[model samples]
Target: MGKLLTLAKEIIFPSRTTCFICGREEIVGEDDLCDACRESIHLCICPPAPLPLDGVSAGLLYTKELHEPMHRFKYRDKVEYAAFFCQYMSIPQDWSIDILCPVPLYYLREMKRTYNQSELLARRISAIYQIPYCRDLLEKTRNTATQTRLNPAQRQRNVQNAFKAAPECKNLSVLLIDDVYTTGATLASCAKELKKQGASKVYALCACKTDN
Candidate 1:
């Protein structure tokens, strides 16, 4: 089964000879990004966490150059992009996380998308670090509006009370996974619910974050 799964990943996410971002047939690195892309995609420097979150970290600073690719990864069924994004998602050494919990989509939205992009990211990171991930630890109870066009205050209102935590989360230090962190309203809301359910700590890790 392991061999089969490996073969399937190779077949589905096939090795890229060119940069996945620019489609340049340059020397792509292990993450499948060429030198130019690797350089242009800036690393996210110590992003601050909002209330209810113990800490937050991100792989890259979300720039205009990344918008289309990130959009495709989340909405266009480019599930394989999770592998590429996971290459940069590093866990901080001091987090002391016990498990990963993905920020979920509402059931109806997930049914339409067929998968939550955050869940895909968390699963890959779990495999890489040998840490367990639990999708059932948190849930999206409301189908909220997209946070893309909203202002920070509006974003906060959009996701407020949208999440619920499971009893199993009690006392566990969790790291929340998502594709991107913008304003952090959504993550903070999720973290708040987790803590209310007795989570010892709730940190967030995203593939990227808005440079703001």
Candidate 2:
């Protein structure tokens, strides 16, 4: 009887998928995550110390196992992974956030990638939470070197003056969304611009964080 039910489920939902992290089929649970992969995820128990942004929150710790999925989502056209990643995100209950703003990509890079991964993640989060999201709230004015190889100071300098906030962001309390938070230089730079444009508060949220 159980085998018959399983077979019927498979036939009815042929597009039912595997775990996003391990690609394990037979995900007999919620959210397309296998038990092992779900158990292995290291969620942030405590939020990071405040930076230029009011606060920071992340869903998972950056681990070697997460590298491939993150890379594929960002650069390998695996946009479908956004839903899996967004499922783990948690917004602060105390934050009176008015909008969601994705950390923007420079035009050339965005064009080359065909889509901004951060925007995709942010939009999914916005849809889930029913919060308005604007991709144009922040704009990357210059193409900078990737932060992956940069030291803390270099990362700070690389993104400095790289972002500009739009007029529409003025006086809005925003939750800025991104894929990863490493040195936090990118988020800080963006926060500075948003504050300059009269945003009341800016909080950062990311899918993954590295120990720094």
| lDDT agreement with native, every candidate | 0.92, 0.87
Per-residue lDDT of model 2, residues 1-212, tens digit only: 69999889878885446777787675446767777777777886545645669988888888777898999999999999998788878898988889999999999999999999999989998988899999989999999999999898899999999999998988899999999988788999999999999999999889999855
Candidate 1 lDDT, 47-156, residue by residue in tens: 67999999999998898878888989999999999998898899999989899999999999999999999999999999998999999999999889999899999999
Give me candidate 2's TM-score against the actual structure: 0.89
**Model 1 Cα shift for residue 91 (angstroms):** 1.1
- Candidate whose lDDT is highest: 1
List the pairs of residues colliding in candidate 1.
none
